[model samples]
Each structure stands twice: as C-alpha cells, then as structure tokens.
Target: MKDISRNDLLTKIQEVEFACLDLNLYLDTHPKDQKALMDFNMLAEEACRLRKIYEMKYGPLTNFGFSLAKYPFNWINDPWPWEYQ
Candidate 1:
C-alpha cells in the first residue's frame, strides 16, 4: 500500500463512504440495479480498507467493536477522528 498521510487517509475513507451512501440510496429505490449494487460493495470495501489503515496508524476510529484494541488503549490517545481539519 502507498504511504498516505493521516489527513489523506481520512479523506479517502470519507470519500468512499459518501459514494457508498449515494449508491445505497439509489439501490434502495432501484433494488434490481446490479451495477449500482456492485459499485456500492466495491466502495464499501474501499472504505473498510482506508479505515483499517487509519486505525492501525493512529488509533481506533471509535471505541466500538468495529476495531480491535491494542495495548495501552489507543482510543485514549490524542487527536480524535472528528478533529480533522
């Protein structure tokens, strides 16, 4: 994987999520659109990938079960995910 900065990583996750949201809304109305469904799945995978990278580098994006916890409890660390500029 490329060495992406923290900000860039966050941006990627956000972008993918946005696209997925749009595709999901479309799918809700047009459930038979296989193309849109595929696109949404692909984007969802991308979002997961970017999120894993971010979490591994900095810390868990949230305190929930979405991410595994490391020693010292990274969630208590500085610079929360919403602190992005």
Candidate 2:
C-alpha cells in the first residue's frame, strides 16, 4: 500500500469516525430501520477497516486493549492525537 502522509491519513480517519458516529446516532432513534441499519453497517465496516490500517501504521487510537507482543507492537511509540495534524 502507498504511504499516505500523516495529515491526510489522520483527516480520513477522523472523517470515517464521524460518519460512523452520525450513523450510530440515527440508529439510536430508529432501531428498526433496516435500510438505515444496512447503511450504518457498511459505513461502520469501512470505518473499522480504515482504523485498523491507521493503527497498524501508526498506533492505537482507541483503548480496546489490542496487543502486538509477537508482532512488534510498540504501544508506547504510537502517536497520540496531538502528534497528528
């Protein structure tokens, strides 16, 4: 995969996160909306995929407790939000 600049990657990640959040809020009030659920699921999957890519290349953004002990996981070396754009 091409190496995206830190700023660009961060922006994309944030956008995906926001999209997921918006979908979640909608779902909260429309739990039985199948179409909305499907759209949310797709957006959520994309957000997760992007988040994983970002985390693998940079560091963990959430505190979901993932370890990389056997895979050179450097939790301490990961960038914090302020380190990004």
Candidate 3:
C-alpha cells in the first residue's frame, strides 16, 4: 500500500473500527449471519494493519500497555486531556 499521512491512516482506522463494531452488534442479533461475520473479519484485519502501521511510526496509540512502547515512553508526549492545542 502507498504511504499515507498519520491523520489519514488514523481516519481509516477509525472508520474501519466503527464498521466492525456496528457489524458486531448486528451479528449479535443475527447470530447466523455469514456475510456480516465475513465483513467483520475483513474490517478487523484492516484495523489491525492500520494500527500497526500507525504505532510503528507514531508510537503507541493507546495506553495501559495495549500497545508496545519504544525506548522513551512517548505515551505522555502526546497532548494531555486538558492541554491546549
């Protein structure tokens, strides 16, 4: 795949994640939905790939050890909840 800006990749990840979640809820109601299950799997894989690409370049996208930290611990480097932009 071609290189994408961090913001673009993040957007893609969010979109895919949202689709996955929505599909998951649908599958919960319709347990025998093969098409939905397949779609969910595809979206899930894409989300993982996008997340790996993002974290590899921009450090962890999450905290509490869900993602690996590099040498300098950059989780605190990003803007905090109350920090101004």
Best by TM-score: 1
In model 2, what is the error at residue 25, expressed in angstroms? 1.0
TM-score of every candidate = 0.92, 0.75, 0.86
Clashes of each: 0, 0, 0
Instruction: Say which prediction, candidate 1 or candidate 3, comes out ahead on TM-score.
Output: 1
lDDT of each: 0.86, 0.73, 0.81
Which candidate wins on lDDT?
A: 1
Q: Give model 1's clash tally.
A: 0
* Tens-digit per-residue lDDT, 28-75, candidate 1: 999999999989998999888888888878889877787898998778
Give per-residue lDDT, candidate 2, residue 75.
Answer: 53
How well does model 1 score by local distance difference test? 0.86
List candidate 1 segments past 4 Å from native: none
Across residues 1-83, which tens digit of lDDT does each residue of candidate 3 receive? 45787677777788998999999999999989899899999999999998898788777777897898898778788553223
Which residue pairs clash within candidate 3?
none
Q: Which stretches of candidate 2 lie over 4 Å from their true place?
A: 1-3, 64-73
Residue-level lDDT of model 2, residues 24-68, one tens digit each, is 999999999999899888888987777777776676775546523
In candidate 3, stretches whose alpha carbon ends up further than 4 angstroms from where it belongs are 79-85
Q: Report clash pairs, candidate 1.
A: none
Question: Candidate 2's error at 22, in angstroms?
Answer: 1.0
